[model samples]
Target chain A: MDNKTLEQLKEKANIIRKDIINMLAEAKSGHPGGSLSAVEILTYLYFKEMNVDPTNPQWPDRDRFVLSKGHGAPVLYAVLAEKGYFSKEELMKLRKTGAMLQGHPDMKGTPGVEMSTGSLGQGLSASNGMALAGKLDNKNYRVYVLVGDGEMQEGQIWEAAMTAAHYKLDNLTAFVDNNGLQIDGTNEDVKNVEPIEDKWKAFGWHVITIDGHDFQQIENAVKEAKETKGKPTAIIAKTVKGKGVSFMENQVDWHGVAPNEEQKEKALKELEVRI
Target chain B: MANIATREAYGAALAELGEKYQDVVVLDADLSKSTKTSEFKKKFPNRFFNIGISEQDLMGTAAGLATCGKIPFASTFAMFATGRAFEQIRNSIAYPNLNVKIAASHAGITLGEDGASHQAIEDIALMRAVPNMTIVNPADALSTKKAVEAAILHKGPMYIRLGRLGVPEVYKEDMDFRIGKGILLEEGKDVTIIACGFMVHIALEASSMLKEEGISAEVIDMHTIKPLDEEIIINSARKTHAVVTAEEHNIIGGLGGAVAEVLCENYPVPMVRVGIKDVFGQSGKPLELVELYGISAKDVAAAAKKAIAKK
Candidate 1:
């Protein structure tokens, strides 16, 4: 990618970070650390990688995405709005009664959401279904899924991993957002999920490790995933929990709690400087 | 009456459905042979998926397939499909209201010789608790085939329970089958014998016995348990004023419980439930298990007599 494109993506990522901070603060309940960490990945997929149309979200041949780590719904909502899936006004009403954006991603109500997901370790299986459908229909559209590193503790994730490889779903790509934090504490202290790349490789996945926040690495990993055939790809991304804001970065306390009005103002000012 | 296992009918129905619907995909968790999905696999090898012994993965993959416009029929033993993978079914399939059909085999104590661990006496109750789920328990092989056809045509989450034991065919192959429609097999004003699954045949036998004893007993095949035929149940309850509910499952939270819930609110008739009396089934022959669990024809007749006496 060129420097100009990289700069544009960076600016978009920072705007998404601001939206996440504001939405969580307004909703008065939601996860921030995980949402912040997943901003760039969601931006890259909705903006550059995926062949999605905001107007015709249900087009059969369009590429699909599943937020497997569904608690990070704010980031997905922000990026979708940025891509014109819905209005930016809907972001503030998230988690409110009768709001289109619920605490979780509801595919029925939300546009550009291929599958409704909040439960962890379940999205990969759905992604495999989409990829298989593409194969069955002879369409070149690919399927992408984003999973949390803490979600690896679920046994179902491994089961889905096995299914993806057993079927030889070369069109499917998975990313483990290795921010290393769970609701309780750090992933290592709560439940060790290390050796992540080796695990996917053993499960017969073509593996790639990259800096999740880096646009060039993100682009390269996706390109590699597309080029590789006959096996699914697992891009293990190393990211910092709460990537943009100074106070929340790498802080376990921000995993699932809304910021106060004063704290939100501070966070927005910090993100604005980057833009 | 022809005798055949409902699981066998389910296998045959899936193969026939594959011929008509090109996008129909079948999945199983190492129980394809027993569940009868192996038949579909044989015909549609390219569309069949055997996810080994992982029921959770089977459900998740089925949900994924449904999202991609494939009508996936995920099959396994009732215990594994409903019990082992309960959360996966609840979150992945039911929550999304996906077009996935879970055709579970070996439901209830009729799956004899497998003992309590394998028998799924609570599968119906477990499935009923989830929203956006349709539950069907066919009385015979013909009804099982019809149930499969109905499930395939209906584009939503469904659970069709089939039994391993051979049951007497209660309906003809050409009988019209619809979801949530109960079949009125026999009619009487003295009492009503409402049954489902293997116990439907027993209920018919009980009705005949009641006739010999100078009592007019009504018999109904309540095939679809959820989205139940409440009109039929309430109308029969009003006429008979007494009821005996029979099923091959536990009395609590199965056919009996469902009937009682409907009648208590609508008609409030005297009722006796003929099923496994809150006990796990031990390994035995199919008929022996049915009798030991107190779900035989004699039990249905006796329960009807008791209900009549109460009235």
Candidate 2:
């Protein structure tokens, strides 16, 4: 976590953000708000945290990541592409017919997608399954999953929450992208998901709250999660709905609507200046 | 022949299979005792996961285990497995074509006094609609055991429907069992009785009754409902010229609907269906419920006669 390394990581995040904008713009439809909000988390995992080999995507002992909030697939696709899991050119063909990158994260079609998740609130359970297998097989590989703040409304999430803790899945870490806004409106306007940290704690998890955009906090939380034992960890990441793009930031309307060419230009220019 | 519940056979088969396949894992949604997954649990407690009463998590966890090369058999009542968590089975398991076996017990009205809420009379239709899902409704204990073994060997999602009632054995231990092929139990020329699950036994009884009436009846045990034994059904229809379908499920979509579809497309024949007449069941004994639901041997015989008269 040196200053130089932090700066490099920030630059990579910006590049990923730009890629998200371009991908969504090209596809003409996708959830850009949540994808942009999760850029730094995805960047840290793929670049600095996860022990995944691009060439051997299906390596038995490799760390696995499930995008539970699958609407934010652009962020994962960008990060995977940057990690050389696939060519950067494939990012542009996302959500298009005959493209390897589907509208949702399809594990069969896309490389580095550990599980196919689109319907919300199922990823943590799937991650727990992998972690349980890892423990059974005596493998040291960890499991990570990213869930949306709005996606917490699903009852299955709580069902899986109890399961992860009940199994004492210490190897599993879940990130709740608390960007506030959902498709219809803000979380407060929709169904409120406040007391998220206490909820995870009550469900028998080690809870860590952090400013999601901060790389130092992100790194520290991951390190602490690895150090903890006997239970899973939930990293409640407080992030903006759209982080890099000023126009889309905290905007509920941008939750699923793709950015037009003019909006895309503005978003990319803002991201470039950050780098 | 011994009378054993299909769920009991599933449990015994899972215990036996656990010794052979080290990668096998069993998951249950707190119905281990009822669903008979407790058999696997007792044999391999470390490999068995009781996922509480949450069927959604049960299915999702099984999907996750499948991705890691573990053969996960997720068990619950057919009502909950196919109804409560249908989306989980569809998106997480079947959409990816994972190697997960949804061995649901207590299918149809035969689940008895738990009544209509617990009975999954339409599970076959629900499972059959999902792509890449192999539906196997075994007729007896031996076939249930074979179906569990076949599911382990098969490399995709499978729904093995098991019953709660103790059914008479329809096959011996050495009976040849295949995934998508039908087992022709009897042959005749008047009418063909295609049945699945507990209804196969009733169909056999109906065939005997038909013989007493001087009508030759053919019976086929269609264990695998999806990727259905179309060849057997078409050939049997051509020979018999009339067909009767028997199932404990609704006549709308179960073995009857599947057979009717195949016959209509391939070889059109006069068909009559013997099942629940598009209605729910009430609390009663298993045999009493079967009789009241109009899925007994007498009903199959009457339906067979109606089909023959139409021909």
Candidate 3:
């Protein structure tokens, strides 16, 4: 939580952002909007918050993370590589056939991913399962899941929310990347997932809101989640559609489109100066 | 040992499995009493999870539990387990090839009075279409018990369908039940009647009727639908030169379709299917529905006779 540590995490976040752009530009297709939006959150967790051992991804006592909003695999793939779960060469093979990094988070193919999630709105339920299992085995490992704001349109998320709170799975924490924009348009135009915080609160989750781009608030929210008991926590992270790059920021067109050569060069240049 | 419903056998087996396997966990979507998962819930209260009327959450949560090394038995009425939560079961549990056992109760038309809405007539077909899914529809209570035990020992996703009606005991308690291996109940030469679930019991009765008519009929308990017992089916089809498939499901995609796919490719035979002729069930007594839906013993006998006549 020190300034020095925070600065290091910020530099890591910029690297992750650059990786996201580079992978998408090479793959010729991937979700860039949500991936960029979640850079800081993934960077913070992999670097500081989560008790994950990249060297031993299957360590039983280690905390588990499910990328529920799995379209953002580039971010997770980049962070896992940066954290040494796999080599940096695997990042270049993103979405390629016979690659460890799939189009979505595949737990079997990838080392660090805890659950195979691509279809949205199902990750939180799986996270609940991990937390519930941890409690049953009397283990102290916590569970974390990252969901998208548009993913909330699916009813299963609410059902899982009720389940997590009902079981008093205080060991679980979920982050909704409230990037405000989805594939079709703004969340308000697509399905209107506003009053998002109140929705989680009504579902009995200990709700927390934070600027997702800020690493300090991300770490503090995770700490607060661990301190709370007898209930799950939902940290509604407010984020821009594309956080770092100039042309892609707050743009719905970048939700799934890959960048061209010129655009990728420009984005990498901007991130380089930030690093 | 006793005549009981398949659902009842599943509940008792679950409670017994709880004592043997500490990592075994049970989950239901608010129909514990009806599905009989309540028995396991009673014995292992701490390990039981009732997600309360949400089948999607029930399946996804079960997948999570499986990931953590907990062998989760997610149970519900077949209609919801395979019908309502189809995609969740496919994407969350089956796609990952997770070690989750889905023991769905009240399968087929014998669920009675609740009619077609509750009856999971096509549950097997739905489950069979998914990759990495093993489908087991037990003949009677005893087989249901053995199937549940085998499902737990197997290290992947399995769909064990149980019926609501109490059926006559077919296999003895000491009978060895192996997955993907058909149980030949009776042997004959005229025609073979391959059946599953409640229809297996009727196939036995139909074989008796065929015996009286001087037409020898072979009876097969085709329990495992997916990873089907092709050896037994082809062997029987080749021997009898005629076949009849019976089930408490639509004739289109259930056991009949599976048998036809196997026979048409391997050993072609004149086959007649006795089932719910691609129509929905109406509110009636379980027996009345069986007779009305054309899946009763007499119907199987008729289908067998028709198939033999063709030969």
Best by TM-score: 2
Q: Write the per-residue lDDT of candidate 2 for residues B137-252, one digit (tens) a residue.
A: 99998898889889999999999999999999788668988999999999999999999998999999999999999999999999999999999999999999999999989899
TM-score of chain A in every predicted structure: 0.99, 0.99, 0.98
Best by lDDT: 2
Candidate 3 per-residue lDDT, tens place, B1-311, comes to: 55689999999999998899888999999999999999999999999999999999999999999999999999999999999999989999998899999999888787889877898888888998999999999988788888988998999999998888889888765777899999999999999999998889899999998899998999999899988999999999889999999988888888899999999999999999888888777777899889878888898999999998898
lDDT of 3 by residue, A1-275 (tens): 78899889988988899989999999999999999999988998889978899889999999888899999999999999999999988888888899888899888888998999999888999999999999999999999999999999999999999999999999999999999998899989989998999999999999999999888899889999999999999999999988899899999999999999999999999988773
Stretches of candidate 3 above 4 Å error? none
Give per-residue lDDT, candidate 3, residue A147. Answer: 93
State how far residue A154 of model 2 sits from its true place (Å): 0.5
DockQ of each: 0.76, 0.87, 0.88
RMSD of every candidate to native, in Å, equals 1.1, 0.8, 1.1
Q: Considering just chain B, what TM-score does every model have?
A: 0.98, 0.99, 0.98
CAPRI class of candidate 2: high
* lDDT for position A150 in model 3: 96
Each candidate: what lDDT? 0.91, 0.93, 0.92
Candidate 2 deviant stretches above 4 angstroms: none
